[model samples]
Target: MTTAGEAVTASESVTEGESYDFVVVGAGACGLVAALAAREAGKSALVLEKLDEPGGNTTLSTGSVPGAGTRFQREAGIDDSPARMVEDLLRTSGPHEAEELVSWMAESSAEVIEWLVDEHAVGLYLITDYKHVGHSVPRLHAPADRNGANLTADLVRACDRAGVTIRTRTPVAGLLVEADRVAGVTVDPVDGVRHDIRAEAVLLASNGFAASRALLERWIPVMAHTPYHGGAGSTGESIVWAEQLGAALANETAYQAYAAVATEAGDILSWTTVELGAVIVGPDGHRLGDESVGYSAFAEVIASVASESFTIMDQRIYDYVSRNEPRFVKIIDLGCVPEAPDVTALAALIGCDGQTLAGTLAAAAASAAAGTADEFGRTDLAGNGLQAPYYVCRTHPALFHTQGGVAVDQHARVVSTSGTPITGLYAGGGVAAGISGRDGAAGYASGNGLSTAVGLGYAAGRHVGR
Candidate 1:
């Protein structure tokens, strides 16, 4: 351990004057990928993570990721290309996305997936074709276990095999800058020891501000009171550090708000509510938007409401899907359960008007029968009508992560507002602004986090050794 004076110098330089080729902050998806890529390019890389474990929010998430024109897609007879993927993203996320950035992500998505499979040994599973998320194509891929823990473990193993050094329980307090370039990082070890990791290139993959209440309110006002589901270490340290060095910020207002979250005590639960067949309703006891819409649209619907809503469904929906779909079984195991067997009783318990709920159900049934339901563009509901012993559980808007951060060019190089490069620093994953523009398909599932993390990390690492 070092005192404050020693800590300062530890951040500034090392006693041996030895320097690595790259230093990655936050051993999450982006950081791990960056470290692996740097090592692949014959550079010594070190990963600093504040948590005791290696995976950040990525481990907590569902392992599924969207990629276009992948080998898996081709073998499965799914016709997709980078151009189609780019067009779909531009259409779904809005035209405001940086064309250069989106283009890079789209073109490199397949390559990233291939890298994960070839190098990291991430087993691929092709499920439904973009049924859950708003992808226009069926590009989502997952490991044997749907939880992101599989992906994280795979990456950890790969990093270890590749001889990348991972320093867990080490928090990066600040960056060391020489002129406009980032030369190293100051880190506080778990035991309170301070150390300086000097490097030729520094990648800020320290995640978003979702876990920091102060930073959330300052950057994304929509998420001020919303609960965060990511790791405790996602405190926007990189965001603050980068901004202090005059780094440009982009899409500061964008964040990913899951439509339904379990109102459990500590952290927000994201997978259970939506993955199950629960239908969200307003306080008036009427169905809100299509529950099947992607996370963005789901968030928009919930955000449009002034009061918290409820999720209503029947045991039949649960039993049917749970028996038919393995993913549904996983959802049930994750804390998603049906409400009690009485619709009226459940409504009363949730403070909703039972009569109004019945009327809404009847209306929904009629619309489904007539094949005229226009809500959220959900036409599939016409097949499965609501049946008895119904259930309802209140829900609130919860944020998974912010979609915006330091602005970067196509090569993952941080750029200023005046179109000048902020030398030496780079960002990826949630630390980089989303390629999706404001006002795009609010619920489009386009692998905004995973694709950008791996794609930009690859670009940054390739640039580092060159």
Candidate 2:
């Protein structure tokens, strides 16, 4: 007879009150990977996705994950370690409440990458091209396409192979708490019928509350009015359910924002453009604060300075970045990038004074040439200077996702208000407090989201599966 936490076939009918070894809420990378890891440990796992299809905010991302001192990094002749990864992350994020969690993630990053690539056949290659934000080394691993949908699909396929059941259109309404311990979850009303699914352990990987205006206003009010570019499913059911269980929240004000979202194309302009020596200028053709602060941090600068702005890059930079980033290529094909031969023509395009535009470009070029900090304190010019035939795209700032939620332990167990692990309740990804700084978008390093997602997911699964 079937009992709680017993292994079951994927095709078996698990009715209400039946139990799974692990019940994963949300079908993003964190949930999928957690389910896969549980199944790998000879446990029957089930993944519940609120949306009709899988892949939450993870699908909208570039799918790049950072790993320090992996075999892939060794193969690529790069020297790195978990200590260095922690250092890099701490350098970018400053001090945060999740410092211990950051160390845990860094220590497990390489193992997670190896497990995904070697055991599960996830197609990941080390990105040696450029480190991208906040990294002192090239440790990002991504699919050839660098698309999160591909990563999510790979994890889903791996789960399927592992006999893990994934149920879509299944929104979790609340947690099933028994004697102050989570026993399972109550599914939201489905056609007016709700099902109480039980499990030995429950993992909340449902991302964050970026889509909820009320939550945004409550937590990160600075971005409450910003455009939300995150997944619609990020309504923060995890936070709601966990809070009822007395889960202690941490870094609730932190988030990841994108500075250069192409207004016309409705796609991010790829901050790689900025890292390659591009600059964001206001509608008045003046440079915004250091475009090199990384895209998430610069979003606040753009929001404070201009409602609508422009990202200016030359042909060489555009060609280089687009060749590697398929999304950028698509943006170019969509005619989002308009080209001008010189400053005068570019000013005409921006509808700003030519003299002001000329002076801005001239000052930036002088800074790049002298290898000194510009007026905005931007010193890292990846290239010599912006040459003629500049490409300018109208852009705006957008809130990509919330980086904070309920606090979690190193094993991703939800921490109670008393700082104890909430029994049987775990969280990862945007459901947990992030390693990003306690407030604002300035602390986000590239790949921080996915790093936490995959790392904590694996950790949670391993701990619970045992």
Which candidate wins on lDDT?
Answer: 2
Clashing pairs in 2: none
lDDT (CA) for every model shown? 0.72, 0.88
Error of 1 at 378 (Å): 3.9
Please write out the lDDT profile of model 1 over residues 1-466, one tens digit for every residue: 1212123654344432547899898888888888888898899999989989988888877666767899888998889898988887777666653557788888888888888797778675765533445566788777665667878898899899988999888888777766557778787787765657678888988888888888877877666776566677778878877777777787766667676654533333333334444567788887777766665667666775734776666675556555544554554555544456666876776677889877777766666667775455555553445667775545666677777788888778888777787777889887887776643227245467777777788778777767
Candidate 2, which segments miss by more than 4 Å at Cα? Answer: 1-15, 189-192
Total clashing pairs for each candidate: 4, 0
| Per-prediction TM-score | 0.88, 0.95
Cα displacement (Å) at residue 220, model 1? 1.6
Off by over 4 Å in 1: 1-18, 265-278, 304-307, 315-317, 320-336, 339-342, 345-351, 374-377, 389-393, 439-446
Whole-model alpha-carbon lDDT for candidate 1: 0.72
Give the distance in Å from residue 323's predicted Cα in candidate 1 to where it truly belongs.
5.5
Model 2 Cα RMSD, 1 decimal: 4.2
